[model samples]
Target: MARLLRRFAETRPDEIALADEEGVTTWRELDERVDRLAGALLASGLSAGDAIAVHSANRREYFEVMAAAGHIGLRYVLVNWHWAAQELGYVLRDAGVRVLFTDPAFAAQAGEAVEGLDLPTRIAFGDGIPGFLPYEEFLATGPAGEPEPQVMGSPMFYTSGTTGRPKGVSRKRSIVGMPVDVLALAADGFATTFSLPGDARTLLAGPVYHSAQWMFSFMAFMSGSSVVMRRAFDPAETLRLIDEHAITNVHLVPTQFVRLLRLDPAARQDFSGESLAAIWHGAAPCSPQVKRQMIDWLGPVVNEYYGSTEAGVNTIIAAEQWLAKPGSVGRPQPATEIRILDSDGVPVGQGQQGEIWFRYANGDDVEYWGDPDKTASIHRTGGLFTTGDIGYFDEDGYLFLCDRAIDMIISGGVNIYPAEIEHVLITHPAVRDVAVFGIPDDEFGEQVKAAVELVEGIEAAGELPGELMAYCRKSLAGYKVPRSIDFLPELPRTPTGKLYKRLLRAPYWQEASREI
Candidate 1:
């Protein structure tokens, strides 16, 4: 097993390996720091499989901790810095996090979350936080040498459950027992498949707490690529970073695409994106209009992948492939089987809408931490499992998602997928963000309803509902247009591009005797 970091350090010592708003770190610097950090984490009494929580925004130290934890055989939980104290505490307790790495910005929430918990180790990066060890000082406590080799560690990410509580997603084929060298080979293969070069530089513009974002950046990092990122995502800054770092790869979501397009013409025009090799997107349904515009402006660098925290990357579509087959999410990756099944669990013919299930040739499966029943519910007779998404394979074998099963509206017995309606509504010039769901109806079991966040400076009131419905009527059937629309100042969306539709739909169903 080759020591990838040390090899990079030995060969290209002065090359930048990581850069954040704080500063830049060279390969040699990063490698030495990781060695010390790995030793410190082990010296702190944490052992293999012990969980450590990182509750900070995107920063270099986050990767340092991740790299150190991986070499020491620990499960590192990437905590959403946006979560409140209660939510943070729930995950901390649930994951049994033995140590916590936080930033000054989130110190208050972290302080409150661990007030009464059994957690004792608390380390803060950047500015000092009360009751927490300074990151630099903590790193100094470990011996300068690299820690002994151990089983590899993996991340345990919590799904942002639209309803109820979030759950930590665990892999059945745990990497805990895998050799670090084997994992690096696999990561390199994955990165290469995405058109990443061995010396690729990746710009992380999204929150790493999301599984896709984590994989895009960290996997490349493991393969010896330098990483450049910022704590928060800014549309103009994102464009600047690409040119500034000569970034070769990046991970983004659909929302970021819309924002990038909305940037002033001057901001968009003064850019050289020649360094970009692949601009990957997923996590939410991207409107064909938005995707096409992106591809037009960025050339064939824009790509898409379909997967979830539970399922991993199942399929991917290149920009050219997407342009030819507009809405398809592409074909399955190697060794992945896609099955669209009807209500009776029978395989549906191609082009027929049904629940999409998957089985991996390597026997990888998803399991929710501490919830056996929840794990069993998503599994089927074979090794197939579902993420509750409804989609179908086209005649050309590309998968197209209709909507999540939970998001489907049954209005007067006619099934309406909100995603289809939302896709049309989002392209409206006046709309910024939108969520379509079902609301209780007297005669009908559910009625299509849309909650829209208007574009900046666009008035939310007036004949907007009628105009939007008229717009939808152009491309969709009468049954698919939202019956009513509500205008909100802002939609409830996470930084990772996931919408909390249940939050908006809950009020409308408070008095109704039904569950969405």
Candidate 2:
């Protein structure tokens, strides 16, 4: 990271390297700031392989903290800005973060989360907080020069921890004799798959706390590409930014696509994303209808991949290819292997639904920090790792993901995938958002249930419960249809597009003794 930043500073010192609502930072300026921040971290009694917690939203300073930490091998734990005090506290303590950096927006939450903890330092940006030092003021405390003997740093991403505590994904640092640098391997794969040019102008439309966003933006800087970021996602503004900035690449999720397509038709018609070369999306399963709609509007620029925070990019499907294959997540990319294993850990036949496992060609593995038992549970006897997802591969080798194993519904001994039902429901004109899960049933072990949020002014459809059920009955098997439909104002979803199905399902199972 230091080498790449230094190269850009020397050759294209004055060129724009990154920008946000706050302003822009050039290569030379970014390099200088990164050096000073690294110095400050080191001067604060941190060293190689230490951890720092960055609790903030998408902003310029978020990247700065990452860039600084990258130089000195600090593991920067990405704290979800939406996490409650308990959630925040769990991750901070688990990662053993020596210093915590937060923005003014989350000052109270950050303070409350870390209260009574043995934290060494706290730094705040954008505005002053009671118990924290000003970020800009603290940055000045270190010398404005490069730190010697640079070692690579990495970010520790916490899993959703839907059932328990969120586990920090700790990676092994590749040092002497390591055949490949993991970051370079990952960056090269991203650059090649997404067509990121050295002169690439990219738009970061999602929260930086996400692993995909963090990896892609970090790779952009390493590739000498300029990044344009927004503090929050606005559908129309996303389209306008692509045109205004001549953005060559951007990342999004299916929910964002739904919002973008929901914009006034007139606004969408005016957006000629002529400058867009790649529109990469993942992190959630996209409805086929929605994915097709995006492809039609974007002109074959839409790209989708399948992977998780624990596993890196495993498969990528381009817009043109996706139309022919329909719902596949393309073929596995180079240096990645995909395997399907049944409940007993036996290999499943092609087109057979089972747990999806990933193995790095470079022999890399992932472990949950400080939780060897949990880490051991996810890893197979081999080096392969499963994120507890169920999917299968076609004869042509394209992978198709089903619902998460944990989310699979079993009714009357018949297995049902909520994703398939949700996919059907998402296409309903009146349904703006929906989540399908299982509720405890006396007759069967579990029964299918769906909670839906209608589109604005959906009352025009006359509370279409009957129509939604009829719509599902047309495509899905009767057993897969929801036994009951609950109309909610909105579904519980994280900003990154992960549905909090656990929260949505907990209420129904409160009186039951059955395990969900």
Candidate 3:
């Protein structure tokens, strides 16, 4: 048996390991299924270090496959189900996926992605996907006992592809020599940092494919925490799940926080999220206003982490700490060393904004799966690697992010961060979401532009833009405030809360000769 599941199955066999919308899966059942699936993968001529792709929504079977792959030495690629056929196909090929597992919900796109590709194995979780093996039947084919030679495996997550085609974020410290026992032990320690003890029950309302969600849920699963998950995030449903399941912790993005805060006053006041001990959020710059509301409503359980798919969680701040240091992402993790460097790679002084770089204590670093040039672009001397985030540390050591280097707008020789404007604009009553970026400005080189998504039933006409601009003027300087505002019914944002700013900014910059 795998080290993780075996220990849990022996001690807490009847405890629920995973609960999706479909049903709950006990630890014993999960252990047995994982063993069989691991056996089947090994029996199908998949050796250690082989790759498989799982393209599905949040489900019990998703973790089952992940656990099975982790027990053996198979790298599991968590595909972004939102990708178009061409984009999906590119990832499948780039990862050299031998077997593809998908949900019936995305059957057509998955099928089109694999069409004429060399991938020979296809397994579907639910009905209605033709030419693919059923998940249950495939599991039944494997041996009932534990697979031999258990080794640790890790996930290879792809970048969100906001800039261009996504690249796989692979760790330089390969998993080939790591044992499952060591892996389980590490997961237990990692979960402890988030206050997730062995008996904690985690609620996963975000997509598991996201690195943060994946780390929170799966690591807790390995540490004996039961997970309650929803297919898609619903504000009311999230509160209900926490109350119903006695959920101890949950992973959320800033966007979800905004939505939850926007819920009816009755709905917000009716349910008490007393069981929630930790509400960790990241993946985007959360508005100070939204986060304050969540903390005020949910007590001080709302914690924040600063990280990316390429760089693991480097900094974290508790709600209390965040209250003291508003707009800060908090201090660096114990094992992380943070450095802010200028454009010439020189380390910047404290309180001076520059590109943020990280150095892991254990010498761990990120690499693109097949693109060495892309990987080298983010690396610097002394084993420091950057995620292109612009941030600075205060004298007290709290990290405050300005924006992504690519998203910085320069107007009349002054640098403006869109996140600062977006954070303030989103606090307005009529605004549901907002995206701020740089547009062509012949005088200032590049001017600030705002794209706002209004609240439900609010029209995008009349004095709303002026009202929003006036609201910003009260809190922002003249250059920092957006020069113009465009109303959209909705902004292009991923489920995980990352805005597709390029999509919003492309049209205005299409005819420009130069790039920032």
Model 3 ranges off by over 4 Å: none
Listed in order, each prediction's TM-score against the native is 0.98, 0.95, 0.98
User: What's the residue-level lDDT of 17 in candidate 1?
Assistant: 91
Residue range 1-516, candidate 3, lDDT tens digits: 666888889998898899988899998999999989998888888977989999999999999999999989889999999999899999999999999999999998998999989888899997668888999988889998879889888898998999999899998889754787887888878787888855699998888998988999988888889989888999998888899999998999988888898899999888988888899999999999899998888999999999999998988999999999998999988889999999998989989999999999998888999999998999997889998999999999999999999999988899999999999999998999999999999999999899999899999888888899999999999889888999998899999898999999999988999866
Candidate 3: pairs in clash: none
| Candidates ranked, most accurate by lDDT first | 3, 1, 2
Q: How does each model score on lDDT?
A: 0.90, 0.84, 0.90
Candidate 1 lDDT over residue span 16-55, tens digit each = 9999988999988888898889888988998888999999
| lDDT tens readout by residue for model 2, 1-516 | 255477778988998888898899998888888888888888998887788999988877888898787767787888888888889998888888889999899988998998988996899985568889999988999787777557777778998767778888766433322222445555666687678865788898888888887766777655667889997999999989999989998889888988998999999989989988888889998999999998888889898888888887888899888999999999998889889999988999989999998888888888888889989888877798888899998998999999899999988898899999999999887888999999998888899999999899877346478788889999988889888888998888877899888999998988888666
Q: What is the C-alpha RMSD of each candidate to the true structure, in Å?
A: 1.4, 2.1, 1.1
Instruction: Compute the lDDT of residue 231 as modeled in candidate 1.
Output: 81
